[model samples]
Target: MTIRTFIKTTGSVALGLFVATLVVRGEESAGKAIAVRHSSTDDTATIQVAGLEKPLVVLHITDSHVTVADELEAQYQQYSSRMDKSYGGEKEHWRTKKKALPAAHFLNLLTLAKDRNVDLIALTGDIVNNPSQSSVRFIGKALNDTGIRRLYISGNHDWHYEGMPGSDDALRKTWTQERLLSLYPGRNPLCYAVQIGGINFVAIDNSTYQVTGEQLVFYEKETARGLPTVLLLHIPIYTPANTSASASSCCGNPVWGWETDHGFAIERRERWPKSGNLKSTTDFVDRVGKTGNLIAVLAGHTHKARTEKLSDSAVQYIAQAACNGGSRLVTFAPLMRDKN
Candidate 1:
């Protein structure tokens, strides 16, 4: 899990190579090359994984936060406008310096993904500001027109309606099934897996900041396939060394347990229970560290980019938000050997 991180400036773009030893539990030595390129409008990363039959290229996009309310949802116009304006900040659109809208940033990412010939589009979460009909329909059509395979899961903002009446779990389930289900694959949107280029790309909805028992079982069954797996999640799982300054906002912050939320979630009117995380949530985190074939975890939510070593076997990579015109191109390739 050791890595040497360095950034190189190439004209207007900054290139980063995260070099690491890709060691799997009960496996021989393997090294992975991760090259990340950052520019004003978009960010891209290339990851090379061993034991693949062929190279698989994927475009990872997250947190676009597009806000579109149509005639059908006139009541939500104010909310949408507020959310949309929030993205006009420098951090949200570094490429255009707030000159472009959030919707524009999303369109740019889609165009870039197509131009790159990406095999799959991995959207971890927050594709929309809420489950509004207009935003959902707009995004769905755009994705369908691409005709490319995709994996999508929910984010906290994707389902929350701000003043909606109902618990977080209830609203998430209701809106996800009623409005967002079509955007996901198969019958279940909570957790699902698809194979691409001999690799298992799994997407799970931990947008609630907690994992359910059902999700844990789904994960177990998928990993049982024993294929090289990449997990897509909205929230990054807690690491043992979770004492970073971002503890207040990150998952698995020791203080994040039920009783000590510190009223951080009060403003949303829906706080995670004071009772803390369930056994299922903690169990899921434990299993992730032990899975032998697991290669990497792709996640978002902090609206920034981060990389953490999940274990000696896997690394968790959080890509920058698409609202800022960010993207990461991940390639899974067969292990190359030198011949004398």
Candidate 2:
């Protein structure tokens, strides 16, 4: 069974199974029950939960690199699951060990998001160390447990694994687009848009390491609608400071660089240079900026918690911390007037 054939045949079977499981579980509500709680913190300190006239709150979690079923415990236990292990070619070992943490972290993330009562949960990407059928299923189950509107985009690690002869096909069959729709109904899994509370949430696949033309088109269409939009993808748009050229390889591991064939390399850097892409980013900003309603650009892939001000524009670029060690909480409110 070649990879292509396996994709055709086995994919169907696996997708069917996934769909069935989803149907059975769809009616069940998961997550901690929201309790009526009050806080005495100063008004400014508390996150305003009263929905904006058109309030849109997004909880973003990224780069979980989760390994399902504790498969990587030995490696994680050996190295203590450090995020910086790649500096000396030791990343693989540590990565293997810490793989299970992502799944656990994902559970914790969901519980936290539920507590926040966010309008939506956005998983920016790197959900698994390498895409595995079981890992994806586990992710689906976890999201269902959270019971909030959710969206998932691809990350670099997601396409790393090549499916076995029949395994690839089996997994595909079990997780088809239609099936995902049934499971996550209304919120399209693969790259689509949904209007929640007058704001447009446009999810795109940035797992391929570069932005594609299709994504740009989607952006144009969504932005043209005059609705404030939130763009979700795995990799942050590479800037000069973080390009593969400027960053040294992780010892012999090519995965850490910006231009590597696999890892974070800027495979399409020429086409999407920092300035050119900045224009693209700006174009997006301008579209929404014109409305004075664009909230923030939410992303993941770096696995570190960060918020960069799009100075010339009103948009804030937010990156969520990895779910493994700690998760970052994002509070959204009208921009403070004093900052002006």
Best by lDDT: 1
TM-score of each: 0.82, 0.57
Query: Taking the tens digit of each residue's C-alpha lDDT, what string does model 1 give over 7-68?
Result: 33332332333333343446522223222222221355444445566777888888988876
Q: What TM-score should be assigned to candidate 2? A: 0.57
Superposed by TM-score, candidate 2 places the C-alpha of residue 183 at a distance from the truth, in angstroms, of: 7.2
What C-alpha lDDT does candidate 2 achieve relative to the native structure? 0.45
- lDDT for position 212 in model 1: 92
After TM-score superposition, the amount by which residue 93's alpha carbon in candidate 1 deviates from its true location, in angstroms, is 3.0
Residue 258 of model 1: what lDDT?
A: 54
Evaluate all candidate structures by whole-model CA lDDT and list the values in order: 0.72, 0.45
